[model samples]
Target: MLKKGQFKNAVKMNNIEKYFGHTAALKGVNFGVGANEVVGLVGDNGAGKSTLIKIITGVFPPTNGEIYIRDKKVSLRNYNVKQAYKLGIEAVYQDKSLGEKQDLWRNFFIGRQITDRLGFIKVREEKEIARKIMFDMIGFRGVGISAESKANKLSGGERQGIAIGRAMYFDADLIILDEPTSALSLKEVQKVLNFVRKIKESGKACIYISHILSDVYEISDKLIILDRGKVVATIKKSEVTLKKLSEFMLKYAHAK
Candidate 1:
C-alpha cells in the first residue's frame, strides 16, 4: 500500500494534443496517475491509446499540452528514453523483450549494471541482485535454475516475470505495461495479473493498457476510457459496471 506521500503524482497531462499530418490523434486529453495506483487505459483499436502512451513516455512530444512530474511543470523537449528512466518511469511493451539465448541474470541486467573498482562488470553482484528481485520481490519459486537458464527455456509466465522484475529492480515509479498478457495462456495470464497486484503493493503505479475489459476490471483500481483521441470518462472501479463501461466506449465511438 502507498503510505501518505509515498508516491507523488507520477505523471500528469493537461490539454494534451497530437497530430499526424492533419489527422488528429489526440485532442486535449487530460489524465493523471498517482503513485502506487493501477490505472487501466482501455479503448478499441485506433482509439488513441497508443498515441497517448507514446506521448507520456516521451517517445513523442505533445503538440499542445503541459506535463508535470511531482507537481512541477516541465518541458519534455529533450527528455528522451534515458530521461524517462531517470524519472523512474519504465515501460514494458507487449513483446516482453528478452533475449531467448541468454541466461536469466544476463537478461535481467541487460542495460544497467554495477561495476567494480577495477571497472569490470561485477558478475557476482549482478546475479545476487537478480536472485533477490526474482525470488524476494517477485515471489518466483520455480526450480532453482542456475541464473543460467536461457529465456526460451522458461515458460511465458517466467518471461513476463523477467520483464516485470527488471522494471521493479530499477525501482520505477510508474510502470506502463502494453497488452502484457495478450499471448499468454489462461493460467499464465493469472500469474501475470498477480504480479501486477504485487507491483501496487510495493508502492508503484502501473498503467495497464489492454483491450480485455474483464482483465482490466480485475486488476485496475481506476479506468480511463479513450475514444477517437478524447477522454470519454474516467471512473473509479467501484463505481463502474462492465455494461456501463461498454456503453461508454460505444457512445464515445459514435460521438466521434
Candidate 2:
C-alpha cells in the first residue's frame, strides 16, 4: 500500500549506487520518472547510463538505496525478472527483441503464450490482438502488416514500434527504451518518436536512453545528463535548447 499523502512517481530511485569490485559504476544517483513524463537519459559511453537502466529493469540490483514504484517502496531482495513484469516495469532494449523468422503475432506472444484449458495456444485471438495493437496502439498505417508478417521484413524503427506497442498493450506503467532510434532513416526515426508520444498519451512514463540528441530533445520533456557515473545536469526542455544541451554535455564531461 502507498504511504498516505505521498506523491506517486512512476519510478523513483533514491541514493542509488552500483559498484563492480573497486570500479564505481554509479555514485549516489537520484532520479525519478513522473507518471506521464518522458525523461531522456543521455551520456557518452561509460557514463553509467546503461548501468542505471540495468538496475531499473531488475537485471541487477543496486548495491545501495531504494526503489519506489508509484510511491510504494519495493525490496531489492524480492525484485527479479518475473517481479519486474508484475510490477509493470518493462524494457525495450537496443536489440529490438524479436525473432527474425517469427511472425508478428508470434513475436508479440512469444514467452507468455495464452493457453486454454487443454494446454493449447489460442491462435486466432492472439493474431487479432496483435493486429489491433499494430494498427491502433502502434499506428502502423504504412505497409500492411498482418499476423503472418515476419519480423525480418520490418525496418529498425518499425521493429521498435512493435516492441514498444507490445509493452503498452501489457499495461506497463514505466517503459525504458535503450537507443531505440539508432541507425534509422529520418522518416523512420520520426515514426518511432511518435510512438514515444503515444506512450506518454496513454499516461505511462518512460526512461529514454539514447545517443541521438536531436531525437532525445524532440521527444523528452526533461533531459538527465550524466558524466563519469554521476548526474551532471537535469534540465527541462523549456530550460535548454539542443545546442546548449550538447555544450553542457561536453563541458561537464571535460570537467571530469
Candidate 3:
C-alpha cells in the first residue's frame, strides 16, 4: 500500500474513466507501476488497453480520473505528448516509433537532437552517443550493426532494441511498450525479453503490453488482467504459474 506523503509508484491512476460519445471505453480503472518493476498488461481485444495507455501517456484527457507521476498530480488540461516526455514518460509502439529510412544515429536523436548554442546539430557527438547507447546501454552487439546502419535494414527485434535503448538513453522514468513481442520469432522474442530485463536492472519501471502470456510470465513482476474496460485481476509472478494464469484468463473470458 502507498502511504500518505510518501512516494511509491512511478505512475498511478485513480478511478480513471474515458467516454466516447455515449459509450464508455474505461470504467473507473485504477492502475500503477513502481520503480524497478516490470508489469505485464494482458487483455483481450477491445478491452480498453489502448484507451487506458493513451490517457496515461497524455494522448487524451480522461473523462474522470487523477494521474500521479512520481507522486506528483498532473494537470490534465496542460498534459500533452510533449508534457509527458518532459515528465519522463515515453512510449515505444511496435513498428511505428522509428524512421525506417533513417540511420541508427539519426533515429536516436530524431526529434530531440543534441544541438550547439546556435541550434546546429552536433553530428559527431550524436554518432558517438548513439554508439554508446547501442553497444553499452542496450548491449546491441549484433554483427554488422553500427551507428550508421539504417533501421529498415535491421530485423524487427533489432529495430525494437534500438527504440528501447533510445528511450533508456533519454532517462525516461516510466517506459510503456505496446505489443513489443508481436510476430517475433522464438529467438527474437528472447532478445526482446532480455532488453526488458535491462530496464529492471537499471531500476526503471516498465509497462509491457503483449498478447503472449508466456513472455509476460517470464519477465513481469506483476500481471494486470483487464476485461471490458476494467482491471479484473492483478497477479504477482510468485502467486501463479503460466498454465494457471492462462487457464484463469480462458475461464474469465468464457464467464464474461
Candidate 4:
C-alpha cells in the first residue's frame, strides 16, 4: 500500500549502489519513472547509466538498494531477468534484439512460444498475432515486409519497432530503452521516435536513455542527468530547451 501522500511510480530505486571489487559503478542513487511518464536518462559514458539500468532489469543485484514496483518492494536476493519480466519491467537495447535468420513471427516468440498441451508450437496462431502486432499494434508499415519475412530484411528503425512492439504485447509496465536511437539515419531516427510516442499513447512508462539531446528532449516528459554515479539534476521538459539542456550536459562532460 502507498503512503498517504506518496505518488505511484512504475518503478523506483532508493539509495541504489553497485560495486565491482574496489570500483563503485553506482553510489546512493535515487531513480524512478512515474506511472505513464517518459523519463530521459542522460549521462556520458561511465556515468553508471548502463550499470543502473542493468540493476533495474535484474541483470544483477545491486550491492545495496531497494526496488519498488507500484509501491510493492521486490526481493533482490533471487532477482533475474525473467523475474524482472514477470514484474512488468523490460529493457530494449540498442541491438534491437531480433533474430537475423528468423522470420518476424519466430523472432517475436523466440524464447516464449505459444504451445499446446501436447507441446506443439501453434505456428498459425503465432503468425496471426505477429501480423496484428506489425500492422495494428505498432503501425509497422515496412515495405515488402510481412510476418514471413526474415528479420534481417528490416531496417534499423523497423527492428526497433519490432522490439518495442513485442514489449508492449507482453504487457510491460516500464520499458527502459538503452541508447535506442544510436547510429541511425535521420529518417530512421524519426521512425524510432514515433514508436516511442506509441508507448506513451498506450499509457506505459518509459526510461529512454540516449546521447541525442534533441530527440531525448523531444519525447521525454522529464530528464534525469547522472554524473559520476549520482543524479546531478532532474529537469522537466517544460523548464529547459534542447539547446540549454545540451549546454548543461556539456558542462558535466568536462567536469573534473
Clashes of each: 0, 0, 0, 0
* Preferred candidate (TM-score higher): 1 or 4: 4
**Model 2, poorest ten-residue lDDT window?**
1-10
Model 4 gets an lDDT of 0.88
Per-model TM values vs. the true structure:
0.92, 0.93, 0.94, 0.94
Worst 10 residues of 4 by lDDT: 1-10
lDDT of 1 at 73: 77
Candidate 2: tens digits of C-alpha lDDT, residues 53-156: 88888899999989998778989999876788888889996554899999989998888888899989999999999989988778887666677889998878
Please write out the lDDT profile of model 4 over residues 129-223, one tens digit for every residue: 99998789888787788999898888888888888988999888889889887877999899889888888999899999998888999999999
Q: Per-residue alpha-carbon lDDT of model 3 for 28-139, expressed as tens digits?
A: 8999898668999988888888888889899999999999998899999999899998888889887888898999999999889999999999999999999998888888
lDDT of 2 at 237: 93
**Residues 1-256, candidate 1, lDDT per residue (tens digit)?**
6566454788889999999989999998999998768999998788898888888788888889998865567677876767777778888865558987998999999977688889789999999999888878887766856577788887787788888999898888888888888888998888789889989998889999987888898899999999889898899999988888877767655533
Q: Is candidate 2 or candidate 3 better by TM-score?
A: 3
- What is the C-alpha local distance difference test score of each model? 0.84, 0.86, 0.88, 0.88
Query: What is the Cα-based TM-score of model 2?
Result: 0.93
| Residue 201 lDDT in candidate 3 | 91
Candidate 3: deviation at residue 158, Å? 1.1
Point out where model 1 deviates above 4 Å: 1-7, 143-146, 252-256
